[model samples]
Target: MTGNQASAGHLLRLIRTGEATTRGELQEATGLSRSTVGHRLDQLFRAEWLRDRAGISTGGRPSTRLEFDAAHAVVLAAALETRHARLAVFDLAGTVLAERTEPLLLEDGPDKVLVRLAEWFGPLLAEAGTAPGKVCGIGLSVPGPVDWEAGQVVQPPIMPGWDRYPVRRRMREAYAEHVGPVSSDPLPVLLDNDANLMAYAEQRAGFRDCGAFLLVKVSTGIGAGVVVGGEIYRGIDGGAGDIGHIRLPDRTDALCKCGSFGCLAAVASGRALAGQLSALGIPAASGSGVREHLAAGRPEAVRLAREAGRRVGEVLATVVTLLNPGVLMIAGDLAGAPFLTGVRELLYQRAMPRTTANLQVVTSSLGERAGLTGAAAMVVEHLYAPDRADARLAALESVSREPHLSPGPR
Candidate 1:
């Protein structure tokens, strides 16, 4: 890559990530010469793509920190849940614009959903006044196993018949049809497990200081996102940190969608809770209903949530023993309220005190937006590759007359 490419890539990452970095810091981070960093900053400032604010004085000299101009560019992020889909427009500064959620009619499957998504983009971008060309790319979070390398959803147990779905291909094609495409620069698409995205959001956005952590989703199904050294660990085949299919020692009767009988998801997932509640004559068509019942102090709902939490915690205790993460961040519909409380109680009680001593389990701060935000983060990270960043920077400069803005991701 050219020096221009190196500068553009480094600057994009600095902006996209919302890092409050100074030129000296950027030079150190990018391993570039002071002159190179200064030259790029000048070019970006001349293009109105970057803005700097005076930062706190250091012991030697006060520094000015750089930030991306939100008005200069935007990213659109989407995530597919079992019951609905979420969409958000995010400025380069990580501000969310026009967040919208719509019900998922799974009966119609991928085609209908993809079309609806494509339709929504035009109106949404118009509302945000963001030109289609200004959008770096879109990131997606799917509710199943994903071949991140191939950008495909592969053999999703919960999303039946969606096996080997070319989600990235269809989405990029549909979006390009509506928005027009670059001759040789097709819009990039990235895919990751939805729960893993949530974990990424939690660890990077809300809990960045926590060097290692586990973010667990106890929603329609159970899944986990594991972060070590501040990076997501996708194992071989991109299935790392997927704890849903781990067998539970006590399960015997429940059958899983994967044709298993004893998985943690089979025993303690939101679907499992709904079934357990339904068997007890409670109304729980949705996990939200179960949460409402718990909030209303319904004893039965409380009892069931607590029991499920305990079961989940028991399964997690083994993982805790193995991973020894610094903290456990729980998300999803049932992860808070009565569910996570019970989990914390049970995990501490069951796991070795030494293991529990340093571990602090908490609810996710990003909540429902975590998945979408992480999707945006994914695109920002991938697009900032040194090979592509210079072209993207040039595109941004040519697309808008504004000064080059610092690109940062939230």
Candidate 2:
């Protein structure tokens, strides 16, 4: 793309984020030439990507206020997991316009899951009246160790069928086949750990003021995502915050899916809760059942969950001592339970006094929507990254001029 298109894409990003103003403001935000800025703005305005309004006079020439066209751009977020899948469409402002959820077991088989996902997303987009060009890209959350650089899901222990799936490539192929030609404006797909996405949502929408934090998602299984200094701390092999497999000091018999023993998930996750509840004759097999039992004030259910909480807290206390994050966000169904309160109490007791004193543990604000919202936020963040518009505009310009710079055969 030309320098003019690059500048316009940047301006469009700013306006979409609700930060647009006069040409002076754009010039200040991005060090571009007055003529170049005007050229870009005109290009964007002509493309219907930006709408201008006359600002109130300030004892001088009235400045034209620019705003992004809300209907001009869209985002598709796909959250794929073991038990279910969720697809959502989000506008520029992070508002979810349309979403659909279905019980498509993701772990049954990778190829089957991929085909079904394509089918699901295609219909949902049609129903929402969303077109291919309007879509910025797709952000996906997967329940596995993701090799972000390779665009593949590394071996996930819990997923019996998905050893290694080229998730990014498959999704992009499906989108391109159904949508439009994969050109400079080709649809991009991003894959990240589901819990990491939850952490992103918590960072952006939840405890925004916290300097450092950890989000623990206690659902069918337990996992954590750490954000230190406003960055997701994905470790070597993208497994830095996989705390669920952390060994509980006192237990060695409980085994993890990763072929280990004494892990937090083995002893204190939703599966553990269900197991404990079942032993107590509570029949609490699912997270929803655990919630129902807690709501019903079932003593056996509460007792076992409280014990599970203490164990989870003990594991987290070690993390607290090591990382010392300012906040600990408990998410998923177990987050709202009194059992988690027990976990919090144990966390404070087991953690160092200074760490406990400074730390604040609480339930997630976004609740069930945290994962989905995080998926949407990932798209927004990717598209709005400082250099994203530059790259996108360059690619679009190449394609617009040549119209043949499509992805080469794999």
CA lDDT for candidate 1: 0.77
lDDT over C-alpha atoms for residue 62 of model 1: 75
TM-score for model 1?
Answer: 0.85
- In angstroms, the error of model 1 at 193 is 1.0
Give the least accurate 10-residue stretch of model 2, judged by summed lDDT.
401-410
lDDT of 2 by residue, 1-410 (tens): 33443456667766665675778878767777788889888766654556778888989988888876656677788787567888888876678878888887765887777767777766777778866556777788876777766767777867767666777777777776665544223467777888888888888886767778898887777888888776678887787777888887788988877788998888877777877788877687666677777778888777777887888888888888988888888887677667677787789888879887888888888766777888777776776564775565555545557766542211
* Candidate 2 deviant stretches above 4 angstroms: 1-20, 29-31, 40-49, 56-62, 176-186, 402-410
Residue-by-residue lDDT tens digits, candidate 1, 177-256: 77654222566778899878888877887678888789888888888888888777777777876788888766767798
- CA-lDDT, candidates in order: 0.77, 0.75
Clashing residue pairs for model 2: none
